[model samples]
Target: MDSYEKLSYVSITPHAEFLRNFVANTICHSCKTSQRKRCINMADDHNLCSECYKTAVFSIERLPYIVHNLRKFYRQFNLKVDKNIPIFLTDKVEMRKEFDDKTTHSMTVYAKKSTTLVIKNCLWQGEKMEAVKEPKKLSKISILLRFGYPDVITGARLAHEMMNVWLGNKGCMDIQQNIKEGICKVMAYKWLDWYFCNYVDSSSDNGRLGLRYIQIYKPEIESNRAFRGAKMAVDKYGLKHTLKHIVNTRNLPDVNQATALVKIMNEPNEINTVLLAQEEMVEQRTSRKMGLIFS
Candidate 1:
């Protein structure tokens, strides 16, 4: 299997040269240098060359078909991709599947590494779901917003990367299948928070941590101080059960105040006002409940 293409920015593929001679009168709106083989024609008078057109169309439009073909390819070949193997997209393709039996053909997906055939309890081999349609109109910004920046790669090329890399051919453990099958709940900002939580070790240089725990916490941890206070509380209390304590005890709405509170929490000698408030609130609540029960 050819190594899959991994693109960080969008550009024209060399194969696009084959497509250029066939197209007439259309110029690539993106690179102006390449004679566009096809125009995305996304909007009024707006057109992208063959490479840009494919990138925009395939990343969103051809995702389902590509996924279907990959599933079928895996099933027919009985190849096993290890759980830890890293996959990449390649320019090479060995097969093409149409969207249906009638209309013109769709995009082609590059094949992956081939090994000895071994049939296991495959997860994707089940009843097929109706294909989800990609919206006809999508801005470049929308594409970037939904799925990060577009690297110059064919939709089939990108599909190759997605299948081998993120989607990992782990039978039932496949994220592509899980997402398409609706087996796992998908959330927007959770991806962002997950990235930050794992990659970012500390708050930003200006003492700012952008809403790290906003999705889970009520009233939302919007400030750095509240986040630090929450962290301190998490160390003492816990994540799942500490929202009430953080919300009630520490309210650092101002950035400056939050910064100051963080300093307090860090110092061993100084009393952390937020932590003190939390402890006091817990004691007060406990006493009140005890008094009511006794009375």
Candidate 2:
């Protein structure tokens, strides 16, 4: 499967087992010490102590607020899409099968026509009554996330999936998979950074835990080649310019080209000269190719 199909995270299994065997001799993935009395093994193959487990599970009720915050955060970058996109939480078994058990955290699926039930309100004798459902076909984009994770992880995953939605809305869905995933990862990383800096308070225990996880995960994201390249582009050229180039050309600009463009912009007098020279070279190449074909 293409890497873009799903977002994967570093599994705590190996680290947990290593700590259990050598370091702290504890089965718990979090709080590696053996002091906790009870440890529960989760379906995803990580053992969390009672106290840690309580905070590890995310609540579905908070999903709407996360989505709302993401939409608000995206506005600063001028990324906008439908206010409502169906997001569902699924079991580890289903997610594992879909991602071939690569430790996937989330996936976004696009459909041309999806069957959905629409309710029609019915009234009898001017009183509110039952509602009837009818199957309706609609184009939609849906996000499926694994059932359990901390709030920070869920927010980051949703932010990544929402970037896919934005791409589809901007008609840039056909771009190369690496570029697409790279941009999405960048957005997710940005969201994490924003969350840590603005929302999280390091004074509290829960806030500190969230910040720690964000620190661990952000580095993993930076390790991916696509993500690294995109981040470099964004850092050097700015997000607005980099995104605009991607949308216009359907490709990431090479370092040399980006540098030259920046130089051309910085030096106003050289803009026409640089552009005309580049255009002339292209014309000459085209003429030469045509002559060779005719000959």
Candidate 3:
């Protein structure tokens, strides 16, 4: 596959480019530039242009989404929690069948009250669910406010990254045929990425880590608003399971706060080229893995 246009995020490859040229030259990423210093991005391992290098060199801003991404990933994947989240605010949920094939399946969820969530499982050739449980509500926003932490927002790019990884993998066991789950994972990664990129990316002597010193720590509210809107799009598109996995647990080391941001990057690409043909059942049947003849 031509990685640049690949259907998966690993195919969405990152590159080291001249940073200033990117801002004035390209509008794809958020722009930040004035003084130049050469440095490298540690997480994705891309070289930073000189303007970006200075902030990392002079002050103490850290890399993006290292811990929160790792922690969120470990908890859902390793701990075996259902990363599918339906409605975060109310926590009520129900799950039902969407798609079923020998190699692929999908489910839906709905919420009731007091954050009560329901999940259903229907698969063609896979094992049946042992049971489903109502998920615990993430701590209330009021509590986080009392504790004086940044309110969690959706992590956009991180979720996209996870989705790409899940979908793009050559093996079915990698993330399984759980297409609904694949959506959830992508949501998580994107929400966190939005948080981290805003928190971690900047040029300043008194950096983002020292945010406590400032009376206001909301330079990124515009991005935050954008993310929330995208998240709402998820809700509108009927993907609540995705919203839950992407919300951050409260608490952070100041240096690692960007990790929390990784929980909800909050930006959804306008183009869903990867799943453009997903609605076409015939195309899905003719897909490489399964060769079922549709009725």
TM-score of each: 0.20, 0.66, 0.24
Model 3 is weakest, by summed lDDT over 10 consecutive residues, at 140-149
Specify the highest-lDDT model's number.
2
Taken over the whole model, the C-alpha lDDT of each candidate is: 0.29, 0.63, 0.28
Candidate 1 lDDT at 174 equals 23
lDDT of 3 by residue, 132-155 (tens): 223444321100000001222212
Prediction RMSDs, each to the true structure: 20.7, 17.1, 24.3
What residue runs in model 2 are displaced by over 4 Å at the alpha carbon?
1-38, 50-52, 57-59, 112-139, 259-295
| Candidate 3 displacement at residue 218 in angstroms | 14
Cα lDDT tens digits for candidate 2, 132-248: 333444446767776445667778888988888888888898999999989899888888876765576666777767666676778879899999888878766656657777888
Model 3, residue 138: C-alpha shift (Å):
38
Best by TM-score: 2
How much does candidate 3 score in TM-score? 0.24
Q: What are the per-residue Cα lDDT tens digits for candidate 1 across 106-160?
A: 2212242332111111111112101122212221111111121122122223333
